[model samples]
Target: MNVNPVELHEVSFAYNGTEVLRQVTLTVRPGEFLAVIGPNGGGKTTLLKIILGLLRPSEGTVTVLGTDPVSARAQIGYVPQRSAHERDFPISVWDTVLMGRLGRRAFRLSYHSDDEDAAREALRAVEMLDYQDRQIGRLSEGQRQRVFVARALAGRPRLLLMDEPTASVDVVMQAGIYQLLQKIKQDLTIVLVTHDIGVIASYVDKIACLGGEMFYHDSKEIGQKDLEKMYDCPVELIAHGVPHRVVREHRHD
Candidate 1:
């Protein structure tokens, strides 16, 4: 039997009575690398916020790991959108990564060998172990993002949620982050929200696209007509072994 790591039932949220999510019903399975793709202002960030327990749904229920997300918040490792954070903060990479140790520190009054080991291992996983001693302020955008990921990994979370993981990184570094994420997926389940259709056809196990409502496709490769119904717009295919769709913006006549 397959167990869902996250489940949302008739979930609705609003700001001042303006509905942002219209009863979104979704399920995310364990060990699945799922991508939630949608245009801006389509409640992509809002939905992630709801899942992270930052905001409670105005209506309906959200269960994460068989419990409310707010109750199980510590079990999740989150990497927010790059723009969501202020990279100018004066903090050393080692101290930043060690913050993930706070959760484990409660058991002991001091930092134990295991906590340090985990932090070092997390940095190693992202290949940023050498930069651990440097200040995050001096690092490049890509390197800084890698450190942020290391902070989350030190928690040894069961589920990792990232909103726009490659947002601020350069094109070349964006590909690098994608490869790094694939390496981490072996131990933890990853759920990322992205609009870049270029790599979804290759990296993701499944694509759950959200627009007006939601469309969950078990197969990344499907019939053209089905995709048309999902996007409700004309989609052009750029055939090059990996199927690519050139989604054009629609104009109001």
Candidate 2:
């Protein structure tokens, strides 16, 4: 039997005296593409940070790859919500991706040929090899996002975590990014956090609707009531072709 790539049991978190997550339990099986959708400040980013071991839960147990998140962090690739550095900084796409290999090194002496090979392979996987020499700032938002994915893939991780990857990209480019993720998910487990409910349903295998609590389903067939409960308001799901979008009904009180 295959072990799950991520498992959370009764996980809860708090800041100061306020609670953020409450009794959240989730399991991500190997090679599964799971999307965590929720409103802003709904603990989606917190959950990803917990899985990355950047923050510890206030309560419950978290296991990643059958080990503690911190212990297994090196085996996990992460694409955060935003890049730390300036986007317009003059940096080659290849160099940016090569940085992913830094975690595998003990010192920053120099990159080896193997590192270059891995970076190139990751770029090719994302169809960004031709842009390797291009300055990252010169590319469109979608292209930059793909380069970020390539950077994460350069680590050769078994699990990939992306936080709002397409937030900065155009709507037209979003589909392509999800398609790329679908292709890559065949080889690794993926956990993506996004608010774009419409485009995700067609790409991900499962959905975990998170607010302060979480409702997980094996498929994207979530009920309207459940969505209302998750968002704490009346919600409607609009279906267009293969994608579905969620719209919360406005109430003037």
Candidate 3:
């Protein structure tokens, strides 16, 4: 039997007496691209933390690559919603990506030839090799995001998790990033959290709608009823070519 990349059975989480996720179960197969959509404070990032073993669930079991998430973390790559560094920080694009290889090295004094090769290959994959020596602060928002992706790729992870990768980029850059992800998904499993339901449908293979509860669908074409149930309000989806729109109906009563 083919082993799943991630599995969560009846998982739940809480923070300081407030519950975030309840009875959430999810499974991700190999090479599948899954998108998680929801409103603010809806436990989307909390669920990712559980899967990454950054936070333990209050209840239920979590597994990654047939092992506990904490034990399998070395094989996973993560791209957070925002960069923690300031724009003025003195760091080069290549050096930032080289950080990903630190986890594999026995000593932090120097990077080996293999580490440099991996970092260069990752930069090339994201079309950022030409700017390797440039300061990260000098790049555009889209270019910076691509460099971050290259940082993750330098690890050669089997599974990748991204949270709001395109939140700060423009529409054209968002499309470019998603297209890059589509090519990368051929070899690894990816789970992304975002609020852009319309744009994500065209790229991901499956959708997971989360609120306090969770709804999973095998296809991106979510029904009206499912949308209403997930959002707790009447919802409408309109499609125009590759772009789509999701609108919530307001009650006049």
After the best TM-score superposition of candidate 2, give how far the Cα of residue 180 lies from its true spot, in angstroms: 0.6
**Which should have the higher lDDT, number 2 or number 3?**
2
lDDT values, one for every candidate: 0.78, 0.87, 0.85
Q: Assess candidate 2 and give its TM-score to the true structure.
A: 0.92
lDDT for position 219 in model 3: 64
- Over 116-184, each residue of candidate 3 has an lDDT whose tens digit, in order, gives 999999999899999999999999999998888888889999999998898879999999999999877
C-alpha TM-scores of all predictions: 0.86, 0.92, 0.91
Q: List the residue pairs that clash in candidate 3.
A: none
What lDDT, from 0 to 1, does candidate 3 have?
A: 0.85
Q: Write model 1 residue lDDT over 170-251, tens digit each, in one string.
A: 8888878878988988857788887655655567677776764566677465445545654555554322224553444443
Runs off by more than 4 Å, candidate 3: 232-253
Candidate 1: the clashing residue pairs are: none
Give the alpha carbon lDDT tens digit for every residue of 1-253 in model 2.
2779999999999978789899999999999999999888899999999999999999999999989999888889999897647487888999999988989974968999889999999999999999999999889889999999999999999999999998978888999999899888777999999887767777887889999898888766776766777776555555343445445554434
Q: What is the lDDT of residue 37 in candidate 2?
A: 92
